[model samples]
Target: MKTGDQTPLICYQEMTRASWRQFRPTTDGHVAAVSVDRRSQLALMDRRPSPSEIYYRPPAGVYWVDVSVHHAMLHLELPTAEGVFAFRAAIDVAWRISDPVRAVKDGVKLCEPIYRPFLERKLRDMSQEFEVGSFADAERHINTYFADRAVDLPSGVAMVRCIVKLAPEDSARNHIQQRTFDRHKAERRNAEHKAHLHGAELQHDWNTTAHGLAMQSLAHGQETAAVEQRHREELEQQRIAHYTSALQTGGIGVLALQLASSPADVSEVVQIMLHQKQLDLESARDVLNTLMEQRLITRRDVQDVMAPISKVIADRLNPTASLAHREPLPELAAPPVGPVGQVEESEGLDEDESDHD
Candidate 1:
C-alpha cells in the first residue's frame, strides 16, 4: 500500500513478458538462476529442455544467483575434404553473482556474454587448419582434435566430453571412394601387365625350344641316311672284290687247260689241274679220284707232268710275295676245242659249253 493518496511511484508491471511468461514468481527481489532464449528471453520454465541443456532457478529475479549451475552444448561447423565437419563441445558453466547487489544493478550476468558458448568463433580460427583429408583420415582428424584436448567456454566453463564428426555430402564420400577405386584399379592393371609380359616370355621360350627340337630331328634323319649310303658303298666294294677273286680262279683253271692240251699229254694235265683246286674241293676231288680209278693216267705219269708245271709256276711268281697277293695265270692262245679229253666224264657237254667248263 502507498502512503494515503500522494502520487504513486510504481515500478513492477502486471503484464506478462513473452519470454518470461512461464517463469514462476519468486519471493521478493532475490536473484534466481534461469535459462533465457537468445531471441526472446524465454525462461527455462516455458522452453522445452534441450537434450544437452540444464538449468536451475530457485527464484526469479533480474540477477544471477550466488550458486553456479549451468550446462550447454556447443555446435560448430568447419569445411573439410569430406565436406562440412560438425564439431560439438559439452560445457558445464560455473556461473554465479560474486556480488549479488552489483549483479542486479548490472542486469543478467549469465546472459549471452557470460554463460553463452562462442563455439563458431573458436572454430573459425581452426577452419584453415582442418582440411578435408582422405576418407578415414578426415574422421580421425576430427576425433583426435576433440579427444586429444580440452575446450574452454564462456563463464569460466570447462568442456566435458567434446565430440567431433564430419558430416559429408554424398558427393564427398563418392569422391573419396572413387580415389580408392582408382588406386586399386591401377595396381591391378600393373599386375596384369606383368603377367602378360611373363606369358609372352614363356611363349617365346617355348617357340625357341620347339624350333631346336625340329632342327635336331631333321639333322638326325640326314645323318642316318648318310650312314646308310656309306654302308652300301662298302658292300659294293666287297662284292666287286669277290667277283674279281672268282674271275682270277677261273683264269687259272683255263690256263691249266691250255697247258694240258699242248699237242701231247696236255689235255690230261689240264683235267688233273681242274680237279685239284676247287672252292671246297669235295666234289672236284671225288671226280678226280674216279678218273684216276678208271686209269685215265698212270700215277707216275701224272706226277711227272705236275712236277714240271709246279717248277714253272714257282719261277714266274715273286718269292717274297704272299700267295693271296699272287698274280693270276696268263691267258692261253689255244684254239677253242670241243672237248679237252675223250673221257666219258665230260661227254654230255656242247662244244662251247665244254670248252668254258
Candidate 2:
C-alpha cells in the first residue's frame, strides 16, 4: 500500500458504527480510505459537517468536504411534575451566556456535576411533580422547550434546547406546596441560629457576673484584714512605750538612793560596784541595801551622815587643791637689838653730868 504524505488528512462525519468502519483500509493499495454501505453512504453524502469539524481540518488553505451519519435529536422526559419544574429551574439557573461558545460547552460539562445532581435531588424532594403517564407527550414538551432554550444557549455546543410543559392533567397544587415547604425550612434554620446566639450571650453574662462578684469578695476580705492588722500594730507600739518609760523612771530613782549610802571614797566604790554588778543600776541598789542592813543605819542616817562624809572626801580629792599648794614658803630669822651708838650716847651723857658736878 502506498502511504500518503506526512501531512494528515482529517475528515468529519456524524458518529455511527458504519461511519467508523469507513476509516478502515480496503483491499486496494490505498493506505487510508473511507467507505460506507449504500444506506450510510447516501446519508453521509446528503448531510453537511458541523462548523467545528470544518475548522479543525489542517492545510489551512484547503477547502472542506462535508459528511454525516444519523443526526437525530435526543430527548429526555422527566418522570414527575417536580422533575419538570426542577428542569425549568435548572435552565433558568444556567442562564448566563458568558463567552457563548465556551458557556455552552461548559454548560454541557456542568450538566453531570451541577444540573444532573440538582435535578435528581429536586425530583426526590418533590416527587409529586412526577405524573405517571405517556412519556411521549412529556418528551415532546421537553424537546420544544429545550429547542427554545438552545436558541439562547451559548454557541458551539451541539445541544437541542428544551422546556418543561406541565401536563394539563397534573395538579398545580403540588408545586405551590413544595415552594411553601422550602420557605419554611429556611425560616427554621434562621430561628435556630438566633436561638444559639441568645444562649451564648446569656452564658457570657452569667460568667461575667460570677467573676465580678468573686473578685469583689476577695478585695473586701483583704481590706478588712489590713485594717485589723493596722490596729493591732498600733496597740503593740503603745504598750512598748508605756513599759519603757516606767523602766527609765525606776532606774533614775534607784541611782539616787544608791549614791546617798555610798562610802566616802564613793567614786571608786561606785566604779567597783559597776564592774562587779555588770554596770546595772539594780545591782548598785542591792549593794547599798546590803551595807545599810549590816551597819544598822536608818534611811535618814544614810542620807544625812554618809552623804556629808562622801561630799567631804570628794572635795579633798578634787584635782584643783594640788594647784593651789604650788606657791613657795619664806625662810625663818631672829629679832635684832638697837644700834651701839645710841647706847654710848646715853652713857656719855651720864658721865658728863658727874664731871660738871
Candidate 3:
C-alpha cells in the first residue's frame, strides 16, 4: 500500500508479514496477506490535519521488524595521577537480513568505513596529562572525532568537565633561595674596590708633602752662608788702616833729632833745606842726610860752612848793621890874591922902620 492511504488494519497485517519473513529459514517461505480495510484506517490517522501532530503518528508505508537483532551499550573508565574518568557509547546492529533490506536501510553496518576508523583514532590520541586544567581540550578531541565520521551529533554529546588542584609551598621556597645568594655576592666585590682606591690616595699625599719640605731647607742654608762672608771682609779692611797710621808717626820723630845735632843754627838750616826739597823739616833732613851719605850731592863742599851759616842767621836777626858798612867822599882846596896888594905892602915896611929908630 501507498503511504497516507492505507487503513490501520492493513498496517497491522504488513508488520506481521515482515516479521515472519525475517525469522524464516529461506527466501521461499509462505507469506500471508492482511485485509485492506484495516490498512486504510492507519494511513488516514498518519495524514492528520495539523503537521505537528503528524510526526507523533506511526508511518503509513510498508513496515518491518527483525526478530533476531539485539542492541548493546559500551561503557569505559580511565585512571590517572590526577583523577578518574568515565564515558559511554551506544551501538546497534541488524541480524539475518536480505540483501535488498540491508542495502536500503540507513546506518545498517555497525563497523562501517566511517565509524571504525573514527573510534580507533580517538582512543590512540587521548591525553595522559592535561596541563591546561580545563575540559576545552577534551571538547576539541570529540569535535575532531565527529568531523572524521561525517556525523552530526545532537547538542551536549561527548562532553567532559574536570577540576585540578596544586601545592603552593614548594613553589615559594625555590624562588626565595635564588635571590638571597645573588645579593651577598654583589656587596662583597664592591667593598674590596673601595678599599683599594683609598690606599692610593694616601700614598699620593705623602709624596707631595715631603717634596715641599726639602725645597724650604735648601733656601735657608744659602742665606746663612752669604751673611758670614760679608762680616769677615769688613774686619780685614780695618786692620790694614791701623798699620799705615803708626808708620807715618814714627818717621817724623827720628828726623827732628838729627837736625838738632848740626853746628849751624838748626832753624835756619832746616828752613833752607825745606825750601830746596819742597818738604816739611823732618822729611827734608831725612832726604838730605840720606843723599849726602850716599855720595849723590858732590858738586857743593861743606868747608867753613859755619861762617856762611852765621851770616845768613845775622841777616835774618839784625837788618840795619848790614846797611852802615858802605865807603866816604874827599875835602875841597882854598883860592889865591894878586900885585896891587904887593906895592902897598913895601911902603908899609919903610914907615915901620923910621918909628923904631
Choose the strongest candidate by lDDT.
1
Cα deviation at 45, candidate 1, in Å, is 28
- What is the C-alpha lDDT profile of model 2 across 39-148, one tens digit per residue? 43311122333444344431112111211111221222334543443222223222222232233223233222334444345433443434434333544544454454
Highest TM-score: give the candidate number: 1
Q: Candidate 2 versus the native: TM-score?
A: 0.25
Best-to-worst order by TM-score is 1, 2, 3
lDDT of 3 by residue, 54-168 (tens): 3343233332222122222222232212344322222221112222222223323332333334343443245334322323454355445444232321210111211222211
Q: lDDT (CA) for every model shown? A: 0.44, 0.39, 0.35
Q: Better model by TM-score, 1 or 2? A: 1
Candidate 3, run of 10 with poorest lDDT = 328-337
Models ranked on lDDT:
1, 2, 3
TM-score of each: 0.35, 0.25, 0.20
lDDT by residue for model 1 over 1-357, one digit each (tens)? 111112211122222243344545454433343443334243422233333332432222322343233333444445543245432323222223333333434443343364343544544445435444342454455456666354544443334334444444466556657877999999999999999999999999999999999999999999999999999889767644543554457664544344444434344433344334323233433554566557565444455554554454443332223233323333333322221232223333333454698
Q: Looking at model 1, which ten-residue stretch has the lowest summed lDDT?
A: 1-10
RMSD of 3: 36.9
**Model 1, residue 148: what's the lDDT?**
38
